[model samples]
Structures are given as C-alpha cells and as structure tokens.
Target: MKRLLLIGVLGLALGGCATPKYNYQAVSQNISKPAIGSVNEAYVGDKMLTQGVFMEREAYYVPEAKKKFLLNIPKGYYLKTGEDQKGSYYQPVNAIPDGAAFVGVQSVLITRDNSFCFVDVYFNKVCNFKNIGEKRKISVANDNSFQQTLIYSGKVGSKINVGYREFSSNLARPAFNNDVEYDLNESKTIGYKGALLEVIDANNQSITYKVLRNFNKVD
Candidate 1:
C-alpha cells in the first residue's frame, strides 16, 4: 500500500513539473513581422556579422560568441573615457579635435583596424558586447515589443471608464497609457489608436466587450 502511494505521488510530481506549451493564439492572432531586415550584414572586427537596429541605433550580433553590441554613439561624436575609484567610465563628446580620438560614444577602444569595442564597467572589461545567454536565441516575435492591453476600471453613473496600455516598437518614444470614458447611451462602438471595440454589456464589477478591430492588424 505504501509503494502504491509513493508511485502516485511521484506521478503527480512529474505531472506538475511538465510545462504547458504557450498559446500565442490566446494572446494574439495578428501576424508579427521583424522590424529589422532579413539579411542585414555589417562588419565588426574584420568579421562580417548579422546586423539589426534597436532603439534607433545600429546593432551587431556575433552568433558564435552569442553576443550583441549596440552602436550607442552617433557619427561626429567622440568617445571620452575617465577613471575614478570606480575604475573606468565612458561618454559621448560632441566636440573634439579632428584627430583627437573621434570615435563614437560608449566605445572604449577603437582598434587600429577601425574595429570598435564597448566598455562594460560592471565587468571591468573594455570593448565587450552584451552577452545574451547561450540558451536565448533572437527572433522576430521576441523583438516585437508592440503590445496593447485594455482594462475596464469601473463605471460611474452612465459613463464607463476604460484604460489602455501600449508598448510600441517606436523605441525613441515612450510607452502610452490612456483612460477614456464612454456613455452607453452615446454609442456601443469605441475607437482607440485605430482599433475599435464594441461594448456587449458592463457593470461596476466587470465588463464584456469584443474587439471589432486590433490595432496591430491596422495598416
């Protein structure tokens, strides 16, 4: 009897350990596309590497090294390095002499071959790229940050309050949060950020609505 009990417990433990597959369909049905080009290639350290753009800056990836580097500095800007009790720190400089180390900002070393390496002050390493864990691989879905979520806060009188949160791929801009109130008597259809929603029914506790359109699918 004890053996049977132990086997049952072990089975339950294994079942609990099993990870369920993520349902992308439950989250969204809209097609996700890559923000960067498919065959973007750039040269870094004499090695041709795949390139990507993030936060309006050029990014390079080293597949074998499993690393990502961002060109955080802009053209015509020089790199400035300083040292203190904290060791080394770097920043971008707007003005410098013609040959006075006019390398991009955030870059620690610009090699004789014109290759660049960024500074990792935490690790005390110079020209080091961002380390993406060995298990993590880059993908379009992961890169797409556009997310829109709507929540119904409650209702006051005849007005219904709805809140919206959005994270768009426009890295240069900030995330958007909005709260809107609509009167049930005015219209059942609601429009937000090019997407439309229809109120089926609602109360102070909860709201029932259907997505007439998804902003992601909007052109």
Candidate 2:
C-alpha cells in the first residue's frame, strides 16, 4: 500500500540523522565563608528600650497627676464628673484593657557593650520589662506585622527600629479612642518608680513619654 511505502521512506530518512547528548548537573558559585563561632563576641553591643502604657489595676502611686474635668450641666441628667484622667500620647489605662494587648519591637540602640546589659522600660510607675542583651529572632507577615525574640546590636551611636507593644482599652461598644502612651512627667517602672521612655527632642530640651502600639515589628 502507499502508506507502507511512506513509512518505509520516513524511517530511512530518520536513520540518517544524529541524536544529541546532554548532561544533568547543578553548579553553585558560592566561595568561602567564616564559621558561625566566628560571630561569638562577649556582646553584640546594643541596647533594648521598650515603650508602653502602664495600667495599674490597683492602688499604685503614679507621679503624674490624675486630672479630673467636669462638664457644665444645667441641672438634673445625672451630672457626669470626670472620673478618669486623660493622659498624653503616652496614654494611660486604669487596668489592662480587655482585648488590646499587643507588642512591637521598634528601635534598638547600643547602650552598653559589656558581657551583660540591663535594659528596662517603664510605663508610669508600674509597667516595666527587662530583656537580656542578645540577637532576638522573629517571624514576619506580609502586612509588615511580626513577632520575635528581641536582640540588640550596634555601635554606641546607632539606633535601630525594633519593636512596640500595646494594651488597648476595653470600655465601649465601638471601642475607639484607645491609645498606648503614658502621661507626661510620669515616672515609674515594674514594681519600682522610674522612667520608661525618655525623649530628648531635637532641641535637646523637650522631654516626653511614649507608648508602644500594635501593627509594629522587628522581625
């Protein structure tokens, strides 16, 4: 048949061509590198500073005055005098606000280069945290959010944005107007009275306290 003749002719032509050879291998270009032990130094030379609002759940002494403002009432609708005091961006909370507990690692500055350095932050005069000096690890999300262990490194004059944490207020339906800062002139820290965050402005004179908010990261 004609089909048989076509197949015979195609086979003869195919036999005349050559087959190419190929190799399967992977090539890496990385050269030399130091061992992990080489990074072992007494310290990474960094400082840790934590900023957050201190919400005292009970009787605690705060240096900042708890201000009370009363609105003018003509009479009768049950006059609501200011029961709670408003604080600065360094806001305040009477007690740990219900659902707003968050922490952020912001900036890390090199404060000491010794074998061990004590880094602590205070809110008002109650909230305080102490972290060991080291390289902290963390996990990050696409939305620029992350959680991690805190680490510190840098020369004496370097500043690194590390982390931040917040304790939001839980006292309303919509749950708005919540802040994570302490009152100005507020001096206090965990079980002791001290300053949490000290901001010497560009003028080198103005001082203010700060609160750590959520949606922050160091990871």
Worst 10 residues of 2 by lDDT: 71-80
- Tell me, by TM-score, which candidate is best: 1
> Which residue ranges in model 1 land beyond 4 Å of their true spot?
1-144, 168-175
After superposition on all C-alphas, the RMSD of every candidate to the true structure, in Å, is: 22.6, 31.4
TM-score of each: 0.34, 0.14
Each prediction's number of clashing residue pairs: 2, 26
Which tens-of-lDDT digit does each residue in 18-64 have in candidate 1?
Answer: 11112212122243222211221111111111122222221222223
Q: After superposition, how far is residue 130 of candidate 1 from its true place, in Å?
A: 36
Q: How accurate is candidate 2 locally (lDDT)?
A: 0.21
Error of 1 at 82 (Å): 40
Q: Which regions in candidate 2 have their CA more than 4 angstroms from the true location? A: 1-178, 188-195, 202-219
User: Candidates' lDDT values, in order?
Assistant: 0.39, 0.21
Cα distance off (Å), candidate 1, residue 163: 1.1
